[model samples]
Target: MTTNMTTKTLYLLCSAAPPVFDVAHVVEDAQARGWDVCLGLTPTAAHWLSGSLDGLAALTGHAVRWQYKLPGEPDVWPPADALLFAPATFNSVNAWALGLTDRFVVGVAAEAIGKGTPVVAMPCTNSAIAAHPQFDQSLAVLRTAGVELLYGESGFTPGPAGLDTPPHFPWQLALDAVDRHPTAQA
Candidate 1:
């Protein structure tokens, strides 16, 4: 499949959130919007989508990555023109803010801050998780680092705990954020 040279690359990262099950549709939406979408997942998220990995790769025309490349190994995905990490879980959000490099999705978002890559994140969490003080702190840290956070009323609002599914992940908001980002316009 041929890609337009002018198409911007979007690193669409997902964490172990319930909405992650719908990631394939999200990728297709991004593609329709003219993005060269590369999918990345947290370890658990990757495991959740294990059966669909190959189909996802075929759909995106790129490898679906959930781990860091080995030393001296060439990067499989192209450099991200912008990143949209939706359905980001509370743990992933905090880990990324704290500069924890343990999880591949969070690690890349963390490093992206320092690299000045435009990033937008929509965290999926319950009211219980959002109540944690550290969760707010992490959101602040990410905002300070220039990561556009889609949370609260503008993004994913936490519902009561123990739901089988989260409020619909605000993927469109993340995509809109990316479209509005200065780097994306350039």
Candidate 2:
């Protein structure tokens, strides 16, 4: 299949969260807006989608990347005009803010911020996890680095327990954050 060079490239980073399974919503939404979507998954997220890799690859028209490519292998995806990570977990958020590049998802997020790429991380966690002092510090660090985080009202908020699914995942808010980013306007 031929890729349209003119289409805006969006890297949708998927981490382990309940909404991870519903990624098709975000992917389809980005596609509807004329974005050429590239998916980067955390190892756990990759496992979650393990059974459906083919369908997801066909959906994005690109490989589902979960690991760093070897030095000799050419990158299949283009430089991202925007990066959006949804269902970002507590560990992933803190790791990214702390400059930990051990995982593919956090690595890309940290490097993207350094490259001045527009990035948005919508974390999915309960209040129990949000109450962690380190989490607040992590969010501050990420915000200081120009990483737009979707939280609070109109964004992602910690939901109560006893529910099989999170009440909402704020996928559109992440998309909106990307849309509002000055560099992403292209």
- Best prediction by lDDT: 1
- List residue ranges in candidate 2 displaced over 4 A: 1-6, 161-164
Q: Write the per-residue lDDT of candidate 1 for residues 58-115, one digit (tens) a residue.
A: 9889999999989999989888999999888989999998888888888888888888
What local lDDT does model 1 show for residue 79? 89
* TM-score for each model: 0.96, 0.94
Model 1 / residue 50 / CA error / Å:
0.4
Q: What would the per-residue lDDT of candidate 2 be over residues 1-186, giving only the tens digit for each residue? A: 225754688899988888999887778888877678889999999998999778888888999899999889998998999999888888999899888899987898889998999988898888887899999999999989988888878579897655556887878778878888776765
- The number of clashing residue pairs in each candidate reads 0, 0
CA lDDT, every model vs. true structure: 0.88, 0.85
Worst 10 residues of 1 by lDDT: 1-10
